[model samples]
Target: MNDVTQPVSRTVGILAGMGPAAGVDFVRLFVAACESWLREHGHPVLDQSYPEHWMAQLPVPDRTLALSDASAEQPLDAMARGLRQLASLGATAIAIPCNTAHAWHAALQERVPEVELLHIASETATDVERRGLARVALLATEGTYGAGLYGHAFDALGIQCLLPDQAARKRLMQGIYDGVKAGDLALAQQCFTEVGEQLRAQHGDIALVMACTEIPLALPQAPAARGWTLIDPTAILANALARRAYARA
Candidate 1:
């Protein structure tokens, strides 16, 4: 069924507005996942189902924001407010798509303790350990860098998380918010390939967690890797979400 035509159940709360593109990615994943779930279980796919809710009708594809070191809390507040909004609308749980904003998950949880948050970082860490990857490299923003969000989560689960070196980090920061987040696909691919190659040189033979959901828009899963496996948090989270949605269905 097309996204527009799907039957939406209770509203799914999404605390978005971190980097607009990441939020867009999560919604698309949610709808597409629902349909994929439907087909996998032999549920009938509708040719068209008018969305009877707000999130189902958010009319835009690319809502990307340029991120910086300054004012991270604004996005977090946006997330919390959105969660409260969805909860008021009877949403069962809330999911935030941006990895960096996950730094505020604890606070958000405190604000809306009744709403369940699909912890992408926590889930990704578990998956990293489950895959037997002891040491993995991460390519995310400075916020995610300073927060040590993934490292703490992964360490708790017996996995080691590595950050890019200073020089690589500088390039990565420029590459993401400037290049990829700006809708420059060509530039984005350039940035991803550049960062990927740099990471290979600096630290070889490790899984590179595309911690930033926006990173995958640049690095699609087509060309096979020689020494690195791209760990996509979006796909990982999607699988986890699908499992949850199905188990409870």
Candidate 2:
């Protein structure tokens, strides 16, 4: 799925900072993927290409904000406001790289009706359905579980999603919060690998979805992902944005 680009100025609105580090990985993916895209096409190393207007370093949600269900409205408001601001700066399209933040997607879309948003759930679900995988395992944060936004997409596609047990879910969520988001790469890696191991031990091939954008940063294509098919939402989101940009061209 590699091709050369004609080098156009593209602005991607990134609504990020669901623990900040995950946000960084999303931007890095776009740059590396696009740069690698150029190099693969036999183009001179593109130096002035990513004209993407990114409003990074936005005020991060505190523990109270992210942990509280009642605080959902505020963060969604902040995200919508951020997108509106970025759109004013000429962002042609928008993408939110955070999975948990997607729980409030309804609210955000309702408030900011003008910007075209690249949805991870719907687009990623399309890929999952194309693979003909009926039963899959989801590994994400508490918000994703509590909200079931990803689950809604899979359900609509008639896919069955299996989640980790409660204890495992707790450790995994903590891994996202105290580990990966905290920059503790080792712990994050351990948590994700352990979860993957558990899923594989079920004695059947299980499709694993890294429903959280922060996941692949810790649990990449390693031993844990060897037997199981790992679906990355962030990569899917990036490709969706690229295709949308292409269609507009």
Candidate 3:
């Protein structure tokens, strides 16, 4: 008689709703990443082969608003609650899709020490480094810029990050809040395109890192955006989470 072994199982958690749409988009990316993993590992694409996962689309406070205004209700508590909820539900590893929300990543990780909380900026920086890119432009919310989330990560990898000017940054924020968040793709496309063009003109044709999850929704559609190399941090983080879920024990 041959000995049989049980397949290892893991649960992936997504703490989202920073913006409802971005959260939904991350789910699609995760599924795609899982499919890629299946092909790479030579595993059959059976329903049972996928890892169990749960997403909590909690109505958390606005991360960008919280970060910019001290008086605004901080997202730490709400995010922590969400994290705890997922951990309690048997989530072995977790990923938060919002870039601005990652500002509270350390605190959230501390609250749920048992679960593996993937860092979006760290994973993105690793991907950028692996691509041998020396410089990149960042298009993100003012909160992410002020927090220096991607700045610190890229700096650690010795990758220079080109930032938009004050006006350009404001435009990018409007693109996120007024455009994508408001369900106006036309406005979002214009704002993202203007910023992308400005950054490209100022620094060369380097890769533009869509550090904000919302940016990817419209940036790809910009006409001028076609000439630039776009890096999707959300996708990078999703792939990282996928690898974690499928890692051999």
Per residue, candidate 3 scores C-alpha lDDT tens digits across 83-137 of 9999999888999999999898898999999999999999999999999999999
Shift of residue 120 alpha carbon in model 3, Å: 0.5
lDDT value for model 2: 0.74
Candidate 1 minimal-lDDT segment of 10 residues: 57-66
lDDT of each: 0.68, 0.74, 0.90
Q: Which candidate is the best by lDDT?
A: 3
Per-prediction TM-score to the true structure, in the order listed: 0.80, 0.85, 0.96
lDDT of 1: 0.68
**Alpha-carbon deviation at 153 in model 2, angstroms:** 0.5
User: Which order, best to worst by TM-score?
Assistant: 3, 2, 1
Tens digit of lDDT per residue, candidate 2, span 65-135? 46455635356557877888877877777888888778767777777787787788888899899988888
Ranking by lDDT: 3, 2, 1
For model 2, name the residue pairs that clash: none
The per-prediction tally of clashing pairs is: 6, 0, 0
